[model samples]
Target: MAKVLMKGNEAIGEAAIRAGCLNYFAYPITPQSEVAEYLAKRMPEVNGVFLQGESEVAVGYMIFGAAACGERVMTTSSSPGISLMSEAISYISGARCPAVFVNIMRGGPGLGGILPSQGDYLQATKGGGHGDYKMLVMAPDGVQEAVEMTMLAFPLAEKYRNPVMILGDGLIGQMMEPVEFPNNLNKEPTNKDHWATNGMDTRKSKEKNIVKSLFLDPKVLNDHNLTLKSQYEKMKKQEIRFEAYNTDSDYQILIVSYGTMSRVCKTVIDNLKIQGIEVGMIRPKTLFPFPEKAVYDAACKKSCKKVVSIEMNMGQMLEDIERCVKGKKEVSWYGKCGGDVPTPEEIINHIKLLLK
Candidate 1:
């Protein structure tokens, strides 16, 4: 397929459509509002439903309602907007509804700046909402990857009967890059009628499908949670995705990063290679499954003495890196939050200091 230059947020909106998602409900916020802007006009052309909710909180439940009916549904928002949607996200997870959420992260604890940040790593990978639930999280480094991940999120969500999150930074939302909509990604959703509350008559089944998150019975709720747990375990085993760069060489240090931050690290690694300072990096594509084994193996390399977690946040992913390394190698964090994305030169300097 021929690639067309497009803004990241717009590409994400189109990608969802290409993936056969027909329902989009979201509230506008910085860095990701363009997704809603693009989808609003496009959804009508495709005979899809596009409605902007009063708030992110309302949008979250809107997604839950569509998803419960087994309709392909998605929403996009920034960090603070996602926070508002957390309760509904938790409810969707508990109900075992399939849905997709794209988070174009902006800086924040509360209404921070509107610049790119990786501060929401924990919220997406760990549980953003309450209870024992995991959203399959994918972090894309560039616009093309963002398009691909967004397209893939739908099937993955339906496969696991859980929410899937496409975690990108502001750069990913604002930047323009050449992207192609894969023809194969647009496939009909399957087996939804069996479980979805679409309608008994429509499905030609007498069984009434109940879509809900509230389980009052203690044993039933526990069993429901266990089922969710098993799905997460299956994802860990089968869906971990990552890119290992410059790993063949015997490197002195390993850098673990994701999203836009990892792109800077990649550039730094290449530049360092010219100076004969070999640095390897593992760029995680799936944040939730987290590429744990890949990180552990890379850190344990006899030639690698240190592992550094490079991110746009104040070391949010640092804890995960530390756990993966398991004390075999020292793990440290280098980051700048609130929209101050570290440059490649800055990353290089940090590595040089580490080597010294």
Candidate 2:
């Protein structure tokens, strides 16, 4: 309704409520506890439900229940909590329940740290849970995108009848920014009623609707996978979103990164420009859809020599980088792990080393 200065984590929680999500379930985790705190107080005032479950395990099951009942439900947690929730997130996907999830990632192989990191990029994009499922992962670089994408996530999840993820770093979650709500949330695509468990009586009398991922027979499983693959093709065509910075230059190096790291890379590019070193970046906004073509295009360019994929993890995104580039151009990676963010100066140094 009105623009406000908000922290990314708290704003994401508030934006979800404003976007008509009344049910939330979560177990608090550091760097994102503000999300839980904001909603615990706000949900009751809006006549909504905010339950602090026993653990992330319980909270995830709570999400499964509410979403199954046709409620717009969501949950927020950091990496380890999300890891605990993955079992339920898998079940939620099997039921084909459209829901929203926010992973304000902290670095970790396990209990690594509480600071900002992009280590979970692959986990978010690829199948993190059991079975063949895809979550529409939206990587937000700043607090504004965090707020806006949190609101956008629900409709997008509803549109595809799939889970949607708001993948942000702890820094992005803690930073402050100005944000505005969409003019009308209902302006989104109309797909909520078809698969949702709204009513049974309104449908055809003889037909029954079942949402599940189980297909025991080999042929049946093959067919089901085909159907999912078709849906992924549509996403590749229609929903591949990315941002390019300084990409038009005759750059010798293209920096491949996303989320807050990509925002930092933007500044690195500016500094490189001052030093007469042309560099560019391809920031994948939808990590699943991946903007693979964009990655290929950049590396295929004659002016671009190599791509340096920067991430908080050692080399999580570099796998995708290898996939896209496929030897068209060289791809190298540099990073800091366990909740350490790479500074612009450090990134520039990495770029210089790559050049050398």
Candidate 3:
């Protein structure tokens, strides 16, 4: 239970091990390669399995295989790597397999850059893969948070019988911070017996539990889709998390951000307040079931004049921000892409422009 200074990627691996995820398969990519490297060494010490697969595409199926056997499994990748794994992610979702994926995103639409960027926001929340399936996405702001969320992912995935993602930008994956892994993170992972494809010899019944995404019958597929939809609605109600900073008082501008960008916005809000500029911030901790109602309430404050979303991409999260505010207020976006980041002063200047 001692706190140690560690990079984000390494911490994620350690947390997963502590959370009883003994199988990890991933391909190394910038900003998150440390996760695999760390696991490669540590997994053996704990009697776990760690494999650097041929590629992200291969790793995705490796994860699916372990998960279908009812074992806790995970994989990590950067944006481009995640793109390759999307097809398998979709299949895993359709099969209702419990697997964890960590995306330490870099700049991308293609192989953009190795530096930090929030360019994968849309891909993480809006489904990078095809079909009507949705993964529970958790966005963390710092290395310590990254550790905690990584541990939480396994339980959530098992609870819903679905895939879960820990979404962080490159900054979070590469930065160093002090973190402590919780001792009570379900070290003895949940049982997945009822639906798991354990061998016939291990099950009570001789009938096999087939794990496949194929549904040829229209009626059966519709029922399956409806079940998925119902779970999503339950997640929205039970899992929405956001941090409200300086939102209790009147403010001139409301800033919405997540992950590393929200950390920078916090500094801007503090500095702006010193100069008699009042600003409040809403930092969403969950991106999928976004804190829409929280955002709408903050944006509708009597003294709130403008809304802005500052990101490290060409404003992917702005789409959700706009949806939350509706047409009552126009949502403005300020962004830098291709691994370019915004400074606190730059964000303060944007706030000034919004005020004018």
Candidate 4:
């Protein structure tokens, strides 16, 4: 199939359709409203459900209800809206329902600007809601990757029976690119016979499945938490994903980044190479099961002098990089938040100062 020119948000909606996701519930917000707009028009044609909830909070539960019945459901929102939905996210996590949510991040702390920013790193990767739960966070650097990852989220969610999050910024949500949907993304809706509460027809029917987060027994709750932890550990071993650029040969500096900021870092590296300054990069695709070992190995390269992290927020991923490198190399950061993105020239200047 020929690639089609598409905005990131619209492409994601189409990807969900191709992936056999038949139910979508969301509220409109800037930088990501196009996803809801696109799905609203397309879902009816495909006989899928596309509902615009009264609020993000309401949408979150709507996702949970549909997913509990074993539906391939999804929702999209920006920063403040995501914050509002965190409570339901926590419930979904505790209940172990399979759902996919996308966050086209904007500057935040409290209703920050609606421009591109990676300010939700901590919120998405770390525990955003009130519990000991983690999301499978995938960060895509471009529109095409966003489409691919959004398509992948459904299968991954079903495979693990957990919520998966696609983490991108306003830039990715708004940018246009040529993308081709996969030919084999047509998956049947998952069977919920074992765990879904779709109702029983006869006495021979199996026991009704109960979906809830409440556990009055301390020991049972502890066991549940441990079970979730085991799933996370398994994902860390089996699902860690990243891409290395200009890393084959030795380089003077190692740059760590993700999402749209990583694209800018690539330009900086290419321009610096023209000037005879060698640099390399590691772009992480999965944020929760972070490619920690990859970052450590790249930073430990013999010719690599120092490690630098460039982000659109105030150094959120820096902590993860530091944890990965384990102080073997000095780690530094450069960032611009509140709707402003650093230019390639600005990033190169930071690299020069670090080299000095």
On TM-score, the candidate that comes out on top is 1
Deviating ranges (above 4 Å) for candidate 2: 187-190, 202-206
In terms of lDDT, which candidate is stronger, 1 or 2? 1
lDDT of 3 by residue, 25-117 (tens): 999999899998999999999999999899889999999999999899999999999999999999999898889999999987788889999
Instruction: Say which prediction, candidate 2 or candidate 3, comes out ahead on TM-score.
Output: 3
- lDDT value for model 3: 0.90
TM-score of 4: 0.97
For model 4, how does the per-residue alpha-carbon lDDT over 118-169 read when each residue is reduced to its tens digit?
9999999996899999999999999999999999999788777789999999
| Lowest-sum lDDT 10-residue window in model 3 | 186-195
Query: Residue 85 in candidate 1 has what lDDT?
Result: 96
lDDT of each: 0.92, 0.85, 0.90, 0.92
TM-score of each: 0.98, 0.95, 0.97, 0.97
Q: For model 3, how big is the CA root-mean-square deviation?
A: 1.3
Clash count for each candidate, listed in order shown: 0, 0, 0, 0
Candidate 2: lDDT of 299?
A: 85
Candidate 3 residue spans exceeding 4 A from truth = 204-208
- Model 2 score (lDDT): 0.85
- lDDT for model 4, please: 0.92
Give a tens-digit lDDT track for model 2, residues 111-162: 9889998888878888678888888899998987887788888877777777
Q: Give the poorly placed runs of model 4, Cα more than 4 Å off.
A: 201-205
Q: lDDT by residue for model 1 over 57-154, one digit each (tens)?
A: 99999999999888899999999999999999999999888899999999999999999999999999888899999999999999999989998899
For residue 137, what is the lDDT in candidate 2? 91
